[model samples]
Target chain A: MALITCQNAAFAYEGNTAVSNLNFAVHRGDYLCIVGENGSGKSTLIKGLLGLKVPQSGSVWMGDGLQPNKIGYLPQQTAAQKDFPASAYEVILSGRLGTRGILPFYSRVDKKIAEKNIKRLDIGNLRGRCYRELSGGQQQRVLLARALCAAEKMLLLDEPVAGLDPVVTRELYRLIEKINHETNITVIMVSHDIHSAVKYASHILHLQNTQVFFGKTKDYVQSEVGNRFLGITRRQESGGEAGGGEGSD
Target chain B: MIDILLEMFSYTFLVRAVIVGLLVSLCAALLGVSLVLKRYSMIGDGLSHVGFGTLAVATAMNASPLTVSIPVVVMAAFMLLRISENSKIKGDAAIALISTSSLAIGVVVISITTGMNTDVCNYMFGSILAMSKSDVILSIVLAIVVLILFVIFYNKIFAVTFDETFAQATGVKTGLYNMLIAFLTAITIVLGMRMMGALLISSLIIFPALTSMRVCKKFKSVTICSACVSVLCFFSGVVISYLQATPTGASVVIVNIIAFLLFWTANSIIRRGYA
Candidate 1:
């Protein structure tokens, strides 16, 4: 069963339509990478799917016992948010805020999940440390752990490796792949890194100026839209080594 | 110095001033962490100016200032938030525009209604005698309410202040909590204006939070330390005002300045030690 479905949806900001006529379904255990240009509304689509923004047209449906609150989100980091005064433990623990039943306090189970994620992310030693003082890779690890605590079934990440070094970025991608593969958690990631996206994602949603193509990774590589968007010829596509070719002109 | 302090506390008005000042300080500091973190600290200054304008009108109409000023200032706080959110005014600019205009209106009202009197001086630069017995009681009650509400919602506030978008995405009702913070800050600013004056009350809201952030990295620790620092500074400022015959509001702000410097120095030394 599909965990999430967006049917003929359109996302807008301040009456300006960003992306429209979007239709996609995310099944359980699918690693979906949403790749698009700078203003192609990838983040807006993610926001619409997460219920942060209402779709201007059509609808987004969460099924198979999935709800909006159960989805974890790791937003793109901003400089101001980076300076937030919080401990790594505190940041991770806040991921359970959605499940705490309006009591405004963390429960024992929440603490356990937070600790488990901390250990899973190998950030146990950084738990008590201040978030602002951590290195970029460590901070991203803490945030990823927080997102894990937020959703055990699904995770949505926006540019999670945007500013990290190549090594750290590769490590994060591996970690996310492990979570998706081992835990059967649905992963929908918005990324500018086309190389990593094609390498790891099971499914690819390529959004262009006025079009969106969603299909299996192999099929996407073979499709005309994919060939043009990924800048791969049919002969080179078979190799599966077309190193992160540029998107459509 | 001890004898003089004791004698100053012997006066009923001084006792009332101390009680109200300490309570207001505690509440201001408690909420200041979120305000500073959210970059809404200047809202205190804006609301205090609105309070001053309302107080001026109340005095002109021969009505109770607290009753008149509280609701008007609260409304202004909400308006400022709305304007900053929806309009092109933005945060700091909105604050500057609202505060300066309200301050001008207050000056005009005071001058036209009562001429150049001690009341104008008291409102601009606070006097210890500004707190009456009833005002003290009211301030204590409101301050306790603010403190209790803040403690109950501490975790939620922490989430909102850290990342408002994420908080809202997680179903935390970020709008309601933002309104709650604005409302509580309005009440604190109104209650504190008579003691700290319109111009200086914002310092009470900004200083303790900034000072505490120097030493504490966690929200809980910063909040706890801010409350401690606020109360200690208020007490010390009030005592110094009494003994040295200084303006109460100015004296308190000076104390905060000294405390901020001390904390900054200590934070630097500690960071160096760790390095």
Candidate 2:
């Protein structure tokens, strides 16, 4: 069954359309990556998915109850987030907020889920440390753990690895792969890094001006539009490097 | 000193003044951390101006300033929220335009109506000596209500401040919470006007949070430390006012500034030594 579905969605800010005529669906346990260049409305699309921005004229349906907690989302990073004053544990535990009763108290079961997620992310030692003081990679992991703490079925990430070093980016993608494989959580991430998306995504959606390409990764790599936009070449495959997609664009 | 204490205890207004200052300080200090963290410290400054405008209008109309100011500032707060949420207008610019316009209109109204040499300085700088029993009860009740809201919605608040989009995605209704915060801030500013004054209230909102950051390593600790520092500054400022014959609000703000400087300096020294 589809975990999320957006049909004929069009989103605009102040009457100026940012993204339009978008249609997509993600089934349970699917890993879908959305890639687009700057100003291609990737962020805007993500916002619509998270219900932060209402589409001008379309419908977005999530799970049966259509509650936010049923799906977790990670927005693009901000400088304010880097300087935020919460500890890793505190930040992670905030994910359990929606699941709590109206009294706004966290129960023992909630605490256990938070702790278990922290441990699962292997951020156990950083639990007491301030979130701001951590390295960029560590902060991203803490945020991921926070998303995991509450999310039961799907994870939506908006360029989660942006602005990170190469090593950190690779590490995060690996971890995301682990999350997809182990938790069986459907992952839909907005990304600009084509290589990472190609490496990790089971399916890819390339969003360009008022258009999109959606298909399996293998077919996407070989598609005429993907080859043109992503610049993939067969010769570079022998070198076994992402630069294989460098020249065609 | 003992004679002064005896004299102060004898007056019902003095007891009320102390209670009002303590309660307002406690609530403001806690809520202030969130405001400062979110970089909406200016919202306190803006709401205070709205309070001043309401006060002037109410005074001119011969109505109770408290009653008039609450609804007026509450409506102004709602407008501020609506304007900020208008994705077209930038948030800070919206706050600036509303605050400046309201304050300017208030000044013109006061000057035209009360040509009788209005002591606006007292409102701008505060006149704790002028607090009454009813003001104390009002402040105490506001503080209690704010505290209850904080405790009940602490997690949601924490999430919203840290990651607003994520909070909304997790079903927190960030827009509603954002409006609720703005409303609470408006009420808090009005309640605190007697203690911190219209001009200096934002100082109380920012300093305690900054000082708490120096000594605390966690969000909860930062909140607790800020509240403690605020209460200590309140009592100390009252005492110092008696000693120096100065205004209570200015004295309290001064004490808070001093504490902030001392704590910041100590933190810098420790960091340098460790490095």
Candidate 3:
């Protein structure tokens, strides 16, 4: 059975249908990329998948013992977090709170896992560093480690590299690809960088406030909607030298 | 200084005032870190205004002010949270709305019922003599409760404060935790209102956290430092208030200001050394 199955799912925002007509099933070991324009409901769909929002129509089913809280989530950075005072390790350890119920403090196992993920991300040096003081790429890596701690099976990332520079973005994408392929952990990312989305993702779900296309990477690349998106991003890449793929979906 | 301290400690009311002030100060400082991070620092000011309004009404009716004010301030905190969360009004605007109206109501009620007097001054600026035995006992119990809950939920609260969306996605019940912070903050505000007054109570909730953040890089360190700063500042403030015969709230704020400046200087020096 698929890990997550969403059929005819529609989500509304403030009484308006933000995204609708979604149909997809995510299997184990699949890296799915959700692509869209700004306000195209890519984020809304991510939220729905994370169980943060309920569909206004149809349903989102989780199979293979996938619980909503168990999904390791890497959310976009916020302004408040910019000046927040916390060590890198402290932020990562908090991911263990996903399954921690009524436990006042982190367990020894929780600490061990956090330390392991920290080492896995090769951020052992950053363990004592303040989160707010880290560079954008470093912050993303720290956040990724945090997500990995929570995600025993699946990782859900929302715009993990929004403001990162080119080299850092490449490094992050590579790391994510490595995590997905090596560990066989399912990866679902909402991104505006359609080019990187295609390069790293095994499957793509394109949305224009609804499902535009959902299929394998090769099929999506050959599909009309895929070509149109690839053409647009290609133009954007040529148009702007500094940015990766341009704005949100 | 030692002789004066001994003499001050001799008075039963002075002892009560010191004990209650310390507890309230600790509570305010503890809640302040999350409140400041969440940009809900002004919620303290807003709730205090609501508290003043309720306190005025309670006084007019010959009712015990703490009993009357606690529930009302807590409800107002919940209302402010709901308004900001569910409505078009942003958090700051909602706070401004509730705080100003409540302050106005308090002023109007005071003028009509009792007229402008020392009592009004006491409510606005606070007094060392305001800590009655019953109020001290209640404050101690409530402060202990706040401290216990805060410690027990420390991890969950950290998760919520750091990232609400991630915490929610992880099934942390972010709403309930936010409400818990608001609830605890309201109680602390009500408990401190009598001695810190309406205008200066929020300083106790904002200064220590900010001062600690200047010198501490880790959340645990910042929290521990903030609590220490709050207790020290409150103790010194009370001493200065007693020695100088000044308003308790203003004195506490002044002490906090001094501590903040000292920490700011130390942090800059530390950074300079690193550079």
- lDDT of each structure? 0.86, 0.80, 0.91
What DockQ do the predictions score, one after another?
0.64, 0.67, 0.88
Give TM per candidate.
Answer: 0.95, 0.92, 0.98
lDDT per residue, candidate 3, A1-249, as tens digits? 999999999998878899999899999999999988889987788888888888999999999999988999999998999999999989999999977898889999999999989988899999999999999999999999999999889999998889987788888988999999889999999988888888889999999988999999999999999999888777776767424474323
Pairs in steric clash, model 1: none
Q: What docking grade does candidate 1 earn? A: medium
* Each model's chain A TM-score: 0.90, 0.88, 0.96
Task: Give the higher-lDDT candidate: 1 or 2.
Answer: 1
User: In terms of lDDT, which candidate is strongest?
Assistant: 3
Q: Compared with the true structure, what per-residue lDDT tens digits does model 1 show for residues A1-249?
A: 788888888899768998888888999999999988778888788778778899898888888998887888888776666777789899999988888767967889999999999888888899999999998889888888888888978999988887777777888889999989889999999987666787899999988633468988888878887767656433344565433332311
Worst lDDT run of 10 residues, candidate 2 chain A, spans A240-249
Candidate 2 Cα deviation (angstroms), residue B237: 0.9
Cα deviation at A234, candidate 1, in Å, is: 17
Q: Score residue B209 of candidate 1 by CA lDDT.
A: 96
Give the Cα RMSD of candidate 2. Answer: 3.6
Candidate 3: regions farther than 4 A off: A241-249
